[model samples]
Target: MPTASVKLAVIIVSYCNVDDVDRCLKSLGRSDWDHFEVFICENGGEAAYGKLLTALVGADRTLQRASDGASALDRPHKRLASVTKCRFQNSAIVVRLGLATENLGYGGGVNAWLEPLLGVLGWDSVLVLNPDTEVERRSLSELIAKSAEGFGMVGGSLVFDSAPDKIINYGLHWSRTTGRVIAIGRNAPVGSAPSSDDLARIDAISGACVLATRSFVEDVGLMAEDYFLYMEDLDWGRRRGKYRIGFASKALIRHVGGTTIGSAVAPEKRSHLSIYLSARNSILFARRFAGWRWICHFGVGLLFAARYVLKGSLSAGRIALAGLLDGAKGKTGRPDVAPRPH
Candidate 1:
């Protein structure tokens, strides 16, 4: 088959994690298909950190044929090239060091700066990757291939940081039968190899590593800005039926989850915010576009809330319930800063 003529532009929104940024850049060097450019949007730092990052990751070096240096992220990069069959022939450059004056959370930060740039450049696809993740060599090729198969949004499997053998996410699943939200291939150890055909038909894909077409962005718009952090992906996913969201089993990214937003162990407010936004926006999303069957969506969310409470996340469960109520009441919460764990 002939290779598709789509050019890709990668957008990574960075927040206070320089090491991860370095690793992420290193992984980009391993991309199997390289007709792409990358834009790193850094938020929540003084200029110094971004400059230091650039120095370490070759920001000053002019874009040329891909070369090598002694950075730790580079060694594995070289190994990737030796093993992978796909060509990493990307022409890449760090256009500018983007540092926001203040934090814009996730959705706000990415949308404000990157969307306009993507629109102007006319890239066929825009990949929004978490700074904490590293892509495998075939990652881009797989995403491109799957998108070519008719999915507007393409997501890959995420391996756990501590146990690279373990799969953190395969894709997102919606259970119309149970109203439950499920993640495909969760906690399955790597090399286990779940069927790619299953992932191709998933209900959604997490935003941690998603490749979306320009049409997806223009139609759905940047994630609902009101969501700030959580559920923005789910919101985007729900809208995807209009364009058909899908998963790319061949593409892979490893994520060090909970680096930015702490997990359930985080403080009450932090945990609460995650639950709140997830619940509220999910309901808001279902209500707005779920058509006449929203009652089913509501029922499923309630059951999902019960599971959280049963799991001993009482506060988080309460927040989820409250968010549902708020969404039902059409209450729009202000974007607030919840403390991050140390």
Candidate 2:
């Protein structure tokens, strides 16, 4: 297939975080690849956040067109080598917003835009990214290049936004026995490089930033919507067998982990919502995929709950136990809980 025919669609799912969305869009504006479109999927955020995202998209579209014109010929970037001049002239990268009437959860928000993205827009590939992530200028190009090399699902390197020099994840590994998802290179210095073999295959890739081809989506299907917020990526990776998952080390993305779910909250006082969803999803994933091994997972979960209790987080421990019970009973969807008092 010709490079021009390989169109990229970028999808970002956001909820009540307009500032992070703004920063993410600005970073995207610096992308060297010009053959992509951005879709912002707003999942039941406040009206103010929706307005801000709309305004930012308008400004970004104008700026992108202007910059494309100014740099059309003069000092052409090396990354534009694959792009034909004719295609570049006719193609206009656009940013669009898709607002949801209600909270669609993480998987649902991205799925909501799949029809229009794959069918109406006719994009060949889709990059699902979180609103709290900022991509490096060459990130998209690197991911697209890897995709062309036949990787069905390609993920970028994620670095900590707070500690720019520290790596957060190069890929992920899910253990069926323990029902835990492990980060491949957590907290390692960015300068340290992994062996080529290590980068070649991983159990899974972080959903914070992943690029998937249309063929892969068609064959493997979209993220499991029942997971709602957590463990959907693990489920997707574990189930897909037709295509291999790859990591693009050259593509760098800075992620502010848990921005939407309060990563900043002290471990001892973490929000009930976060604790509940994580526990419930882990059990659900284990039971669905691990079969009888869920007994081992239950034991591991008990240890986790006990740790929280030892740390004086009584609420977190109790919520986690409740989640485990609910998940075993086949309960799903967003749970109703009152907002935490300020």
TM-score for each predicted model, relative to the true structure: 0.72, 0.85
Q: Which pairs of residues clash in candidate 1, taking residues 3 or more apart in a chain or in different chains?
A: 32-87, 34-90, 165-190
How many backbone clashes are present in model 1? 3
Best by lDDT: 2
Q: How many residue pairs clash in each candidate?
A: 3, 0
Supply candidate 2's per-residue lDDT for 278: 79
Runs in model 2 deviating more than 4 A are 45-49, 53-91, 191-201, 264-266, 338-342
lDDT of each: 0.65, 0.73
Worst window of 10 by summed lDDT in candidate 2: 79-88
Residue 118, model 2: Cα distance from true site in angstroms:
2.9
The TM-score between candidate 2 and the true structure equals 0.85
- Tens digit per residue, CA lDDT, model 1, 1-342: 117568787877777777777678778886777777676556655653446344443434322324443333222221111100111223433323355555666776567545555436546888888888999998888888888887788877678877787787667765544444677788987745447676554666787888888888887777666666765676677777578766666677888865666653443334556667667766666666666565777777787678777876676667778877776766654434253332
Please give the lDDT score for candidate 1: 0.65
Q: After TM-score superposition, what is the CA distance of residue 27 in candidate 1 from its true location, in Å?
A: 1.1
TM-score: which candidate is best? 2
